[model samples]
Target chain A: MKRILIGALFALPALTAMAGDFTASLSIAPEWRTDNRDSAYFVAPPVVPVQHRSARQDLGLRFRDGGFNAQGTLRVLAREGQTPEQHGIVNQFYYDGDLGNGSGYTFGRKVISWGVGFGFRPLDVIQREDRRSLNPPPLTGVPLAAWEHFSADKAFTLVWTHPGHRHEATDFRDQSLAARYYRLVDGNDIHAVARLSGRHALEAGAGITHTSGEEWAFHAAALYQQRYSKTFNTLAESGGGILAAANPMQEVMRRNGLKAVLGSQWTGTSGFGVLVEAWYDAEGYSRNEWRRLDALTARQRSLNGMAPASAINGNVAWSSRAFERPNLLRENLLLRLSHDDERWKPALELLVTPRDGGRVITTRLEYQSDRQRVSFGLRFLGGAADSAYAQAPIKRMAYFEWRLALL
Target chain B: MFKNALALFASLLATLIALPALAADDIAALLKRADGYRLLEESVRIETLVESYRGDTLDKERRYTVYIKPGRRSLVLMKSPAEAGQKVLMLGDQFWLLMPDTQRPLRITATQKLLGDASTGDIANMTWSDDYDGKVVDEVDIKGRRCLHLDLSAARPGVTYARIGLYLDKASKLPIKADLYVHSGKRAKEAWYEAKTVDGQLRVMSMTLLDDIQAGRRTVVRYQSIVALAAPDEFFNPAALVRNTLAGW
Candidate 1:
């Protein structure tokens, strides 16, 4: 705690100098959505009611002048009948400096984007995302320091997350450290990253994106990761517990696996962009493992009213599989289309599980001017009762949100 | 008969040889004078508004600002439409496009699209003399004024246009028109430059581009508030570009 305070204090001097150079922005978006689900079983809001209404307001303050900059956001959330709650988060607050010789550094809380995949980036290991909609809500930043160097066609980035913000069980070495080396080849970018994480074991990744002329583009990314190292997949049979039916296993699975994405994008002169992608998760549960977990979930549900809370907790994992794994199913195929022209831009994304026939279709139409944006979208989930997407509490939802930036 | 044939062959050979040398000198002079009209060593703060027309309908309209430092660096800030707050930075052969919401700067090619018909390279690349090899091809007259037609080829790959046909007014040496050709040897697009006298020197005020593949689809980019200024080294840095601070402004 003391070190964390000191680290935060470092920003104070820079912040004080730029205290008056701040800009404020406020936006409110009220949304209405509908779904079809049983009201009794909907205990909490991983999913909302069949009919729901909410108003969300965002307030942002940014300070950037001289050599320092910071941005903070506050969210005010209100349900139709529930008490309003307010939350604060730091989008990104960092001090940027040039060290000469093509070197620079940023120190503060900031979100890092590891461009691993188009829609689903499995290698974005630092973030445990909130999966509610197709375009998930933004993730909060972590306190860290990053350094980067650029020379010719090559760039190097070094990142240290969870720097001084810690309570127990971790020293500086236990923090996550990541490094990336990027090179330009034939006007394309090819990058490789290696990470040493305390929670997760060693991870290595590589990605390449190339545009072949003006009409076609191709990209591929892959990551090698250890299984079940702080990774939660509730639909998979937990290999760590001691039960009669359960097999005793290691905390980290011995079989390290690969997750990969291969995709291509094409754009027409008439302003239509199309993308097709294939995603594979080698660490995903097999059919037998899924069956076992399904049985366990059924058993847990059957004992829900009869068993006590402690007994239910004894089960290794029990919850909806909607948020589990990258796709809950092994093989996923995605097709996305977006229109770049200005008159009512429309976008669509479809995620299909080939083996299970589960599909999630999301489409949205939006109008964005210089200072305002209004959008309407629909999310439809379809699958067999036992398939992946059908397990979600909601069947379909339609919503509209409009935001006007007031500064 | 042999002697007469030799004499004719020698005369034809001399004419062929002399034609190329003369063309080379003329092409060099034309490029040097055309370079004065543009391709300067200065920074410009201008809003390039593009309005594209498909048939009678206005298909797309947008605006943006590009910071050009000639051979040193290039940067772009999209001001309106969908991708607002995004900035693209270029240093040498390296290019990175920073989206509005994402944290990392995505590496992009120079030929990538910024708005309709206006490529990133089209706005960023200032001087063409270094990147293209050219020769005068023909002399034509239009509207009672002589014009020199030239063909230019890219010296490197990944340039926006593999080949370009340029026409310049013989008197003022001002660029009149150009046609960009794709690798398939098809005329992809054509551009017409409108010149205006600014501070007693002729400068391009607007460019009209028409897509060859999609007939009736055209884009016109109008330049506003073009001024000559020098940018410091820090202005070209990716870090500074993403900051969007007053220093960059």
Candidate 2:
């Protein structure tokens, strides 16, 4: 795969010379992380070592000729205390062929995202993008074949994802068949999607977006899954055992899961904008589940002198894995304010979990020129001493990235 | 003889009363003629180049391909390296923007649509007869050329400008200059049109916009080429925006 990606990169210049639209860019990003030393999970010996800083450099290219399109990235990564590594990513490689009467077919890897909402898109069953991630990289397309038909105001699409692959451990890798229907009526956009898979059986969703007057836009989306899965610590759920020798976390499957999001945005003519969104995920941990896990960790911490430090630290580290989930709680609210003034864009975002009074605040700024763009941001995890964000092992993170277009 | 005189007086009064209506028709005809200098056909494919300058020095440049259809439908595709694969679809009063990274069509309001330096409306909308209506206000001389000044108000709610003061060449009825007013009735920008003979027809090939709020900033929009093309209706659909490659078109 690496060899193929390198070869493709080498061919981009030749492709450009031979009658095609080609684009290339170079970017450098460095990220810094701060750890919370006061957290109960933080032990003197350190159960899990953490890296304080990392940097990445990327050379990306994209080409489009007729119905053929390809995009790839060559990356060099370095960490605070590790050797530099190099790799390549084939972000997208697809061929689109047009059929008669407003129909088309796509073969190979492509990015197909259909949803409505900025914070959480319940209808995005295929990509399942994590919207809250900080300083994310370019998305990689999934392997699939799709057929589509379109009209003046309506469209229908059917896709087969991960063709020839069996059910995988993760939902994204699972083999599935998905379809979407979209329509525009009286200034309202309506969308519906359904997916069939072996693990989840079936998932269906619908969404709508509407704009009123000249400044406001409203969107709502909801998805229902026949089955969903979550990982939980067995010790906490059983109400027993202060410490365990091995990891006690295990995955559990449940029936009837739903995810929903409602949001609205208002933009003024002066370039200031505000967005408010709230979402609920059945797969996320509930209030009682967090309380149980918190109680388990507290009970384990009480045995400081009685038990070995490694045992307690190990158990706490295992429990801390709960924070890795996209949403720490089942319910979340997001508020973002931004200003776009032609060349500069600045934004502030706040994510709150109403159940535990937890919140994450982020500030971002970007300056765009004709051929270069610079972006930087800072994020702090805190709010309420007992909140999940406050108790997490990581406290704050900052990052800066500069990008230049070469072609 | 007395009755005949009374009938003739009534006829004269009616013509006097209908004079304003006749003038309105003339105004509409003039606007249509001015529109022809910008849009030669009901549907066209235009290649546009936009350059932003600060004090006569070029600061930024971008390119776009615009497709305009009847019934107020248009699509703008960004071709600049900074915004490659970005598309904006406009249908009547509604708009949707599709970014290259997300591959999702996001709905945007009229105010949000006017955020960029060269707004989507500036690149896509070429005809004024469909979005504005008014009467001729006066005939004046600008730069030694006789011109007719028209005061026009938005007939459609989705227009980027709420009102406009337009000047057209009195003889050719070609658009010469316009003062754009926002919803607050404040002059936002001043636009001057430049026409050139292309393929034996006079067409507005470039437009220069002077910023009213921010002094010393100017934007020039140049049409590299324009040809008659009725793009398939499906390309105008918001949902179909992601699917249409438009490779050959």
Pairs that collide, model 2:
none
**Which 10 consecutive positions of candidate 1 chain B have the poorest summed lDDT?**
B238-247
Candidate 1 versus truth, CA RMSD in Å, comes to 7.9
lDDT per residue (tens digit) for residues B121-155 in model 2: 88899989899998876667988888888899999
List of chain B TM-scores, one per candidate: 0.83, 0.90
In angstroms, give how far residue A300 of model 1 lies from its true place.
4.8
Quality class of the docking in candidate 2, CAPRI style:
medium
Error of 2 at A297 (Å): 1.0
What is the two-chain DockQ of model 1? 0.19
lDDT of 1 by residue, B141-194 (tens): 855768877899987655667898988897787888889887668898898888
Measured against the true structure, the TM-scores of the candidates, in listed sequence, are 0.76, 0.94
Cα lDDT tens digits, model 2, A1-407, are 44654675577667678777888888899999898888765544346866789998888888788889888888888887778788788899999889989899999888888978988888988888887788888888899999999999899999999998895678878899999999988899999999998878899999999998889999999999998888899999998778998999888888999999999999989999999999999988998998888899999999989999788888988898898888888999999999989679999999999998999999999998878999999999998888788888889999999999877
Clash pairs of candidate 1?
none
Model 1: lDDT equals 0.65
